[model samples]
Target: MSAPTPSARVTLAELAAEAGVSLSTISKVLNGRTDVSRTTRAKVEVLLDEHGYQRRGTRTPKSRLLELVFHELESAWALEIIRGVENVASENGLSVVLTESGTRHAPGPEWVEGVIARQPAGVVLVFADLPQDCRRQLESRSIPFAIIDPAGDPAPDVPSVGSANWAGGMMATRHLIDLGHTRIAAITGPADVMCSLARIDGYRTALNAAGLPFDRQLIRYGNFHVDGGRDNALELLRQPNRPTAIFAGSDIQALGVLDAARQLGISVPGDLSIVGYDDLQVARWSSPALTTVHQPLIEMAEEAARMVLMLREGEEPNNLRLDLATSLVVRQSTGPAPDAVRPLAAVG
Candidate 1:
């Protein structure tokens, strides 16, 4: 007798109830999420082989395209990430489709609906705060997703790729402290972002480690952009006791900090020192060449793309959370603290 195909006999819903797990759990077992325990995988595998079941449906699958969505695709930073994704996608014979969320940090309702209509094999979200409904919709359809540098906490079962943000922050801050700069300030990414919050925590931890008090006034939130860095740096510089060194959350912001300092006639690494994050191409070209923490943005993007492809091929990752290492890259923008520049009037 011939065996019954997935569409012919048992459905995933029936198998989920039989196994006493949620639909998502069954989907994870099929698509290969490493978070599922070994015992659970064995149980699901037994049932799958017993029933000769395969995936959610037995129909011919959707197109061989993968979706890459971003909050906003601008800046050299975004371009680097794009290049990584494109490299992997093209090599695997899969086309890439790019989407921008426009005004919001995550895709809107309309965007999600459009994705459902198109039904790509999988998705990669960069700096997106995945909405609960969006997650449910994708899971329901067995459309896998992996996040790159998620803006907020990702779903517990979802795979994600990012650098060691906390370590990067600590390293950047400690470099300044080691340079004998006691008056150090940090301009971090948005307050709501998970990576931003982690980076700030590392900053505070480093200060506390050095027996320095955490000064609330010295901390400011930027939007991971140049303007935000520039404006915030301007404010910090105008204070009566301006910081001798400033750590901007991103390279773009670091350049903006340099701009602000130039406008005030302050010399880089002479009157002031600057440190930035995400050692991008511009970081090397900035007037003084930025000292920064390398965040491995391209590598993370590439990993995310590869994960999506693996999900499409029905392979589980060896690990669910992949974090690349970050290290400090010293350049001309940083030096020993200046002796003469102690206080500031206002730079209007």
Candidate 2:
């Protein structure tokens, strides 16, 4: 069957009649209410889509609130993000509404329903991608959204803010190489994560550019946490020909590496050098200040908030994807390689 013309105006009553449902049922389906039966809701939604139905006059008024959603609040950077979002929200006389939604991939349906009901000014989601259904619901109501993706992976069509993860990795490895460390190892986040792959690629590239050998055995992947760092560092440090320097994926992981070095009676920057990612507060507070990559978490959050606000104002973003630069922060955690250490077996 041919689809209805875009210029044709379709009313809620017409949609209800076409679906053989009550007008309230149509409204419930539109609002994402769970009370309506799936079959009925599906019928109404198909009709709505066919007719290009848009609730022009009935659009919910935007509230004086901005929604900042995270899959979880446990990360060290969560506070930084919150501070940045609040900075923008307060300046614009909008209160920030924080929500911890579903998995890292997307927010749950319940969160979507709450957002549709509240009709916030805009939303900033810390996720890899926004689910299509959620995006449609938000867009249908004229609610704008942006993704703050630290994972170095985002949907191309979506407006997103992320950091230069590959560059950060390259900087960390290059620093160690410049310090005359030939036997270096790296522990990054999960192998499946795009950021992890980008970082490891950076590490390999730096090694290649410096005429150093890339040893697969010297690379490890784990969660971006203290335990992942500690466990992986212990294994790498326990080897007879252990690396003289280690580059960690996250600041939290670097702490774990420090603990491992201490347990093995290895001196920081004396017998072993360490570099970490994310210049978090704890990085400076450690026994030996951590040498790390400075990811602009707060600035990234601010940029995402601004982008959403721009969209709310019916303005298009200059760029759908923005990757902020990363810089290396030198600290006491890294130093030249020890005299006794040498490059891996393949490199003499």
Cα displacement (Å) at residue 88, model 1:
1.2
* Candidate 2 lDDT tens digits, 162-266: 999999999999999999999899999998899999999999999999999999999999999999999999899878789999999999999999999887778
- TM-scores of all models? 0.79, 0.90
RMSD of 1: 8.9
State the local distance difference test value for candidate 1.
0.81
Tens-digit per-residue lDDT, 4-50, candidate 1:
75467678789999999988988776655667898886787677666
**71, model 1: CA deviation in Å?**
3.1
Clashes of each: 0, 0
* Candidate 1 error regions (>4 Å): 1-62, 102-105, 342-348
Q: What is the lDDT of residue 286 in candidate 1?
A: 87
